[model samples]
Target: MKRRRKKRSTKQYAVIAFYEKNNRWPAPSSQNVKERHLGEWITRCRFIRNHSPEKLTEKQIQLIDRIDADKAQKKTERWMVNYEMLKDFVEKEKRWPSVNASEPEEIRLVNWCLSQRITRKNTPKSKLNKEHIKLLDDIGFHWSSNNKRRTWKESFNLVKDYYARTGQWPAHTRDPEESRLAKWCSKMRAYKNRTDTSVTLSPGQIKKLSNLGFDWTNSQENNRRSPENTNRIWIERYHHFCEFTTNNKRYPKAKSGDPQEESLYSWWMRMAYLKRKGKLSNERIHLLDCIGFRWGKGNE
Candidate 1:
């Protein structure tokens, strides 16, 4: 034979109703269950104020308190994850979860939720005991798991790891995996100064890199394919172009991924700007003309 569930009392429903009506909880001495006089229960009551409120007897109140206290103690026993979040998970998935949970820590919680469905269509929130929540909480019970919730140092290390693997600091790349590293670069730049993904170098960053044994070099090539709304990155590229001319003894061509190409593109644009303002001289123009540098609107 199936066991019968205990029936709830009218006074128990009244307590819930009163809490819903009044935002704050009432004091134990505020009122009775049916707004009745408590003196009828005890003869010549000298201290009626010390008696149980909610119209329940003293023994019944003690039993409820002991039961709740015992449940709370067992719920918190060797558990760390928030029990409320687990309840929220169960409420969303009409049926209980199976074993294949995405997170390893969530697997046990899913199993606990599955176990709650003894024979019901869904395990109601009221049906969940402290033991059920406690089992889920234990899965995330280590101090090491709590460590990830605090620091961003691990996120910063992603860029450092990329730099180590490639022997170069990650640039603003759109190449799927490299682009993810570029995000870290952008974040670090934004955190330090309100800059974009250019990841410019500073004296402090240089010092930090040196201490970390990272050899960050400013190379004479750009990752920017076209000359857009940027100046500093192109300036570095121009500097590298000048170095390339001296060392390679040849003019740098437009290499798809090379630091050069359409290379002196922005440098030429800057020169044109200075020329329009009469700041550029005929001497400088004549010199670049020798290296086959393109001038005018469409990269000449």
Candidate 2:
């Protein structure tokens, strides 16, 4: 008797192997569940199914779905690269923005301004505010902050520093009242000889004389001298002459057994003679002829 052919369980074996590899069963509703197995398993299963595959196991389909879902989630959650961070890395490594050495002086200055760490307001107008002005002034920078046009404080500081380092004040500061007074005193002392010359008026005396319109000049010849004015001028000149002689260590000689005390007019006449003869310079002449100096000779 002919024995009945046994049916091969290749599909069942394939499903088992697929479940073992994936740790999960294929989906029950998938049409290609059987084909989702490993190559050896798929070949055996295809041969078993008469080379006409049907649905795959639910476990295989489920495994594939899980893998696909995991891949999609990973793609969605991938770490992104920050452009700024990349730029920073490139700059540090390659010096991306090239630094020019000597473009223009002005450009460099502008760049310096831009690159400066701005802790305070750098605008000229902002820096010239009342508070900053006071601060700068307290630090010895005397300047005017007006109209927003210039940096007077900076210029003042530069000038002050230059003077301090050089021991010379600016031209504008050299003509102070004290300096002028000192110059005048020196000139008067230099010409105290060669003629009857004297300085009766101190700075205070001169100031008083100026106020009284008694500052005699060649141009003041039009003003005729009154007796009182002449007497006062002579007295002042006499005092100046006494002071000059005392300072110069000059002793007056006596004539005819009497002390040769010169009068103001006599001293003035002698000085005028010396000046006309070109024996005296203008400064000496001026000192000798001054109203106070002329009168001072007699007292000496």
Candidate 3:
């Protein structure tokens, strides 16, 4: 479809900004902005978005770039909650430690801390402490030259994508991406398959994939329910939580001795998974927005 150029104005810029934020053109009747200006602007944006995205203005490009950078910053921040606790643990340790689900909270704390470089004092740690130095002696504990440690979302996205595109789990030897990460992939497969003793990804990532119908164990590989069935269960539970909130006028609590607390945490974890992928449905978005739930906090 050909796009007819629309007259531009100051308020029409809101349409562009909204488009950048939502990854979609808002209706001309959007009450959040100048409704009158939205019509033409939305039309033009949808046209460019679908057929000529390269024509986006410098400011529009900058806004979109900023959105991505902010998401990356939030991802880093989400990993920060355990940094201090992990650093404290390292103060008394001998060698850089290994982290598995079976490992104590201290080990998982290390895992989370390894993903953060900035300290709570707002300064980046320039030098490693004795335990950190000792810990880095283990190859798995060392950060890459690019300083990339896998965030839970990043780990899930890669493997989830690999399986989606190839219709099979990545091999232990060489995945389609590269042979360099093959060893890590092997460890991930073993952990997911329950054949390995250590955990490679966080528990939340494991559960999200399982909820998406992944079954890594060879003999139990087909254990997953149909995708539709899995999605229905998750969506229904999320709505039930929202219903509880609607009746109580607040969010559900994840607290000790509450059986529903564990379920609430799992729902939020799945929400984070969808958030990272930018795949959350609009209905859930509205409900979450109504409750003002913070996605960055995850379950904790």
lDDT score, residue 122, model 1?
24
Q: Model 2: per-residue lDDT, tens digit, 1-300?
A: 112111224445555566688764443223353533333233333222322224444543444445446545654343112223324434465532222222333233322222221212323354434653454344343232122222323232333333333333322222232243333333333433223255343566445434433323323243335544443444345344444344334433433121123332345556556655876566444434432233234455
Off by over 4 Å in 1: 1-182, 192-267, 277-286
RMSD of each: 32.1, 50.9, 18.4
Clashing pairs in 3: 96-135
**How are the candidates ranked when ordered by lDDT, highest leading?**
3, 1, 2
TM-score of each: 0.22, 0.16, 0.29
Off by over 4 Å in 2: 1-219, 251-300
Error of 2 at 229 (Å): 0.7
Winner on TM-score between 1 and 2 is: 1
Residue 244's lDDT in candidate 2: 35
Top TM-score model: 3
lDDT of model 2 at position 123 = 31
Clashing pairs for model 1 are 220-240, 221-259, 222-259, 254-261
Which ranges in model 3 have alpha carbons more than 4 Å from their true place? 1-54, 79-85, 92-95, 99-300
In candidate 3, how many clashes are counted?
1
Candidate 1 worst ten-residue window by lDDT: 38-47
lDDT, candidate 1, 1-300, per-residue tens = 112111223443444455468633322222343322121111101112123234444543553454345546755663334455565666776543333344534555643343333212223465546564455456442211111231243334444455543445566432433555565555654645545546555677656645645423233144222332132243334445444544444444544443233435445566768777987667456434533454555653
